[model samples]
Target: MAIDFGTCFTTAAVRVEQAGTAASGVVVTAVEIENSRYLPSLVCLDDDGRLLTGRAAVQLAAQRPERAESHPKRALLRQSAVLLDGGEVATAELAAAVLARAADEARAQRGGTEPVRTVLTHPADWSPGDLDRLVEAARLAGLDAPELLPEPVAAARFHAAEVQAEGDGPIAVYDLGGGTVDTAVLRREGSGFRAVAVAGDPDFGGRDLDQALFELLRDRALDLDPEPWQRLWGDRTPASAHQRSQLARELTLAKESLSSTGTVYLAVPGYPEPFVVQGGEYRAAVTPALTASIVLLERTVARAGLTPAELGAVVLCGAASRTPPVADLVAARLGRIPDLAADPKAAVALGALTDPPAPAGVDTGADAGEEAAQDAVSADGSRRWTVAHYPDEVDPELWF
Candidate 1:
């Protein structure tokens, strides 16, 4: 089993070996949780002080925002604990809850048989200390010291095996996730890939794009009638909070709808009419951020001692990479059309499972010795585990 615990959603995949047949091969399939392949990466504290995950957490969060921590991975980077509902919850504990949920669901799919090997993907720029915390989280979740893999390396592996781009040059991965954008350049060694360079902006991601659209909505709302908008912003009542949450969800749906259609309508709280937003307006609003991401991709390639033209392929990972402007910007800046994974959200998890397994009789524990041993393998051999260690359209009111 392989897990990609992401900022906005969690994905897991299981590797099935086909045996006793002439066409024996390995097939990787995404694990479905709660009837959905993408599990919400949310953790909420229940009335009993127990952590709830997936749809349960999301449902609870909608009613009580203070009791939920929406981004545990991001929280793990800054502080040891996060304050939720007037209590301090350990960040690692929050992360463990999500991991446990994924592992449990995956196990159920395998007829309650535990995975022989579990791999988790992380950012290439993560430090040793960060990896230690991740391993600790896995331990708390009852995982048997799973192997760790760098996210971009996994994406590159997927490209080499599945896409099979034409060239021996390195592959550039542009991962625009929910809360961050990571750029990496990786070269295939033998059966695996190694990261040559990585660069990213921790503060920039899909949420930033959402914020830009929200600002446009705010401006339009204020112009229509400042009184209701001010009331929604300042009121602390439960009803007001629920309305605010609904508006946020609606805004997100509108943003996604813009990717496929020209216009979408959004309903604002305390307003009788819906407002209109155009696809062009959203693209214009997010162009600067997309351009900046493309620039980072270029710089990462240069850091790898190669030019954009020298890259064999540029792969796009993460669900937000589905935004229409992202590909356009990449082509416009890099002079190459980026390859989008068949299911961008599950690429890393699937790729992690695709990695060559460790040689038999090797201790795959969360220990420095084992990690160092794995790192000693030849470039053509198995790669070292990076230790570880929807809105409907409506009549137009204001167009921004």
Candidate 2:
């Protein structure tokens, strides 16, 4: 099982293999929550002390403004506890709640609590402390000591297979997710790849683009009436918080639509009027952040001892990669068209399952904590049957 615990969304996939069949390889299928593959990583606490996850947690965000932890992955970096339902909860615990939801989904999808090798993915540059915290969270969520895989490595592995990518030159992975941008260069090393260099800007991501869109609406609203705009767009007041959630939902939809269309209409919740955001305006809003991501990408490749011309492919991963500005920048900067063959959202999880960083032995129906049969192998000869705890979350538009 591979859990892509994204800041804005979460997804889980399992590799199923038949016994004694090396030719069958392994089949990777997404685990569903409420019949949908991805689950919103939002978490909240109820008045009764119950922890709610995914859609349930998001649904409670408006009703209990202070209790909702929107991006627990970001919180992990701060190593802080967020206020939730009138109390403080540690970030790792919050992450555990999300993982527990994935674990439950895994059990239901696999049909038992069978002992399975677990793999978890994290940002390529996450400190050992952050990685340790996630491991603890997985243990808290009732899973074994999971091997950790880096996001870019996982994405590169997944894309390499899709394109049948080959060469001594490294593959550059540009991962623009909801909360961060992680760029890494990995070259094939025997059966797997090794990370050569990595760089990222944790402060920027798709969320920044969404905020730019939100700010545009807010600026227009302020022009209409500052007093009312301040009431809903400023501070932590309940009404303001609720309006923020509402506007985030609105802009998320608009942003996704803007990816394919020339314009998007946003219905402002706190203001009397709706706004039409042209494609140009949206692109302008995100250009700075996307430019920063590109700069980081350049630095990453330079550090990896290669020029953009030397890269085999510039692979795109994460939901934000689909944004036209980002995709366009990658193509222009690298002079190689960005590969989008895999679903940007699902690529990391697929790669996590395909080419985990560690040599996690296969679990051929092993008992929990006990060894079983030989490892399962993909038809392409990569080791298989590793379960992972990668991060995932819904794209903002999917929350509502």
For residues 223-325, write the lDDT of model 2, one tens digit per residue.
8778866766566777667777877887888888888999887776555667778999889888877887888888878877789998878888897888868
Q: Which pairs of residues clash in candidate 1, taking residues 3 or more apart in a chain or in different chains?
A: 131-389
Clashes of 2: 22
Error in Å for residue 16 of model 2? 1.4
Which regions of candidate 1 are displaced past 4 Å? 21-23, 355-373, 376-400
**TM-scores for every candidate against the unseen true structure:** 0.88, 0.85
lDDT of all predictions: 0.79, 0.73
Provide the RMSD of all predictions against the true structure, rounded to 1 decimal: 9.8, 8.4
Single out the weakest 10-residue window by summed lDDT for candidate 1: 390-399
Candidate 2 residues lying further than 4 Å off, grouped into runs, are: 20-23, 165-169, 234-243, 355-400
